[model samples]
Target chain A: MPTFADRLAEAVRQKGPLCVGIDPRWESLPKAIRDPLRDELPEERAAIGYFEFGRKVLELVRPFSGVVKPQAAFFEQIGPNGMEMLQLLLREARLLGFVTVLDAKRGDIASTATAYADAAFAGCTVDGDSFPVWDADALTVNPYLGRDAVEPFLTAAKKADRGTFVLVRTSNPGAGLFQDLVCNGQPVYRHVAAEVANWNAPTRGACGLGDVGAVVGATHPKELAELRAAMPDVWLLVPGYGAQGGTAADVKVAYRPDGLGAIVNSSRGVTFPFHPDDPDWEAKIVAAAQKAAAELKP
Target chain B: MPTFADRLAEAVRQKGPLCVGIDPRWESLPKAIRDPLRDELPEERAAIGYFEFGRKVLELVRPFSGVVKPQAAFFEQIGPNGMEMLQLLLREARLLGFVTVLDAKRGDIASTATAYADAAFAGCTVDGDSFPVWDADALTVNPYLGRDAVEPFLTAAKKADRGTFVLVRTSNPGAGLFQDLVCNGQPVYRHVAAEVANWNAPTRGACGLGDVGAVVGATHPKELAELRAAMPDVWLLVPGYGAQGGTAADVKVAYRPDGLGAIVNSSRGVTFPFHPDDPDWEAKIVAAAQKAAAELKP
Candidate 1:
């Protein structure tokens, strides 16, 4: 099996580093999609609507992007039915030849973290029989729980030839509450960045990157450049592009000279470009994806 | 509706501070429970076994503990079927008159955070209809994303008369990697603890404790004592008892003079006391819960 780093590298090389995020909102979905599901049960309707729309989005954006990230929170909002849809959508994205990243931001310690990682990659084992769960190419994790906690996810991912993105510098306005605190003459995020660099070292692939990556928001271009320099061989999953006030130029610092080190994610900007009532929502998604792909070319 | 703080205070007063953590693993489940589900599909079998085992554990431990926390990662390992079982299990736990805490450790920013919070508390809303998702009394949150990320959860919980427990000094040994960093003459966790205290102030209930709580590990009794002094009005959910090697005496510092400030958690210690092949597993579980309840009494 190809290492997760090489798979991601090939995807970015073919698709120009644009990762279209699938963050479905019932209120933001096109009227045509929502109107038809009005008579079904609330969760059922939302699940069906999200799955149908997501499946369409996959098809529409496939020409412009090679990676699709489905935010777990949005699908989780609708409950079990929604989770079922999320599972199906992930499988669909994989079948469509897109590298799927389940952006769950999950974190914990020991066996608990292993459980979440298994669900994201290896699936469940019952009576020696294995069943696939999310089976995504990668998952997004939070690094607050420290070494032992984050190590479980990395171990599980390596066993399955998958990848993980650790949160270092988030894009939210108040993200500096703890991340920016100066410790030992360096900020907390820099420490986290240093750890990520160490973790990514042993897993370096032929693409000059590793299976363990760091999430550095595009909203902070300075930090992005710093982190890029700090973790030269680590892949970067950059959010905060487009809809979150980050421009193409701002995220330019994330890429290496080879254009293989970063993948810029645009969730609402590319996926929900159309108003809920827009009749041409599919075309709008296609156009937005095309624009993002062109603008994000490293 | 009574505020979550008051409700929790009432429960602790009635049943002491033992919070039973339901973290089911297929390999750890009793042979009797596992044998019956052998013919079902892997995920289905695991989900069914977890739900059945969880329901039994709830009934068994109800007389001993008023608060029951269901860890989301274990259930999620079984995929959507496991999540469905989790929802049913939460409903069952609530119906049995236990204060349910969903130990998801979720964190994100803006609407994404709201989506997770809404699922944990207010349920999902489609059009004008609302449907309950997890419906736990409180949900565990990771505060690494800072103010905006944590506030959405607080806001959602407040709207539903629910509560949240933020990770402060976690019980894991490697937790000090980032949480113990000294910044501005104090460790990072102390800053998080101060923020938790501030967040808990406005929502103080009649019992003097507030809806926003902090998770302080029992293993670090010294820090637990210090945090208890720092956040007088905030409730503490203390994990790392028993199986994690934290003695009852260690967690005693988490309490206030009135003994209403802390709820100590025991997962594998209380739930998986008996070996899988042990036919007397039920009795072992009962004895463990009974002993833990008595030992943990404030």
Candidate 2:
């Protein structure tokens, strides 16, 4: 099986570097979607609404997007039923031939890390039986626990032929509070970038990028470009491109000159492209996705 | 409602500093307990077995322990069914007057962080309907995403009168890989320690401690004492007491002179006290909890 980097590269080549983010906020969803969330305590109705939106979005973006990043917290917010919906939607996205990045940001160490990897990728295990749980092609990881914490997830991704994006320099306003603090006369994110490159080096696919990737905020174009130079052969998953005040030009430097090193994500900016009252909400979502895809063209 | 700091201080004063960890590893369960895992899929049998072990452990430790730290990854490995079991265990512990700390290590930014805080402390919401998911008294947070990542959690915790423990120096060997790096002429964790104090300062309860706490490993005795003084008003949730090899004397310095600053944790040491084959395993678990409580009595 081809690694996630290879698959992602193929997707990018076919559909440009656009990856739709399925972050279904309740208030952002149109009434048609939100009306069905009036179910009982189990959130069965809400789960259906959430999955329906994602299912529709997957279909809408299938022609324009190569990958989809579903924010786990959003689905997880609706409870286990919502998680059930997440699993179903992810499986649907995979079946539709989109490389799915489950935005879980899970981090831990040793066996704990292994358990999370199991739940995220290969599935859960019982006495002697293994059950497929969240079938994500890739996952977002936090590297706070160091090498041991990240190694298990990497190993699991290798086994499953999937991938991971390590949070390097996040896009939020307060990200620099700690990530940009000087360490060895450089920001701390630089050290993490070095480690991410080290982790990626051992397993480069035919695309020259490894299953290991880094998430450098598109909002920080200067840092993104610096990190891009610092860590070649690393696939960058750039967020904050649209909704988070990052322009297409700001993210241009994150890509290789040949335009194959990065994938730009526009979540709400593209997905929730209309006011809730817009009767043409679904049409707007599709139009927005197409425009965003074009804007991120390499 | 009283703040988590006030409640935790009272619990410690009543039952000493011992916080029993309910980390139910499926492989670690006795043969009798693991016998019921013959169900098809959905991890129903496995969830039941995990919950059974946890229920027994909670009963065994309830009398001697002031608090319980349930490692979320263990339960999460079993999938949503396991998460449901986690909610039940946490609720049971809360009903029995235990200060439950969900060791989730979750971190994110903006609304994503809010969703996680909701899942951890309050509950998942759908429109106006709130599903009581975890209902933990407090949660362990990963601070790698900086202040914004942590602020939503702090806000949600305050709303629920709950609390948070930010990871400073973890108990694992590889924790120092990034945490100990010299940043601005000091170890990186020192910077994190300062921020934890900054976060803690605003929420000081009558006990002279705040709802925002720091998790400094008991293994690093010198660092523990230094962090204690550096964040005097911040409560310390010290792991690495028994199984991780931090001796009683090593963690003695983690506490204030008046014995009110820290709570020592012993997961496997207290929870998994005997070999699975031991006939008197339950008694041994109780004895271990009692011994650990005495050791951490300060």
Which clashing pairs does model 2 show?
A: none
Tell me the spans in candidate 1 whose CA falls farther than 4 Å from its real position: none
Residue-level lDDT tens digits of model 1 in B30-144: 9999998888888889999999999999999989999999999999999999999999999999999999999999999999999999999999999989999999999999999
Supply the TM-score for candidate 2: 0.97
Task: Please write out the lDDT profile of model 2 over residues A1-298, one tens digit for every residue.
Answer: 8878999999999998888988987777788877645554446767788888899999988888989999988877777677778889989998999999999899987888988888888987665678877879899999887888899999999898888999999998899877887877878899999999999998799989888999999888899999999999999999999989999889989888767889889899888988877889889988998888888887
Which 10 successive residues of model 2 chain B have the least lDDT summed?
A: B33-42
Per-candidate Cα lDDT values, in order, are 0.95, 0.87
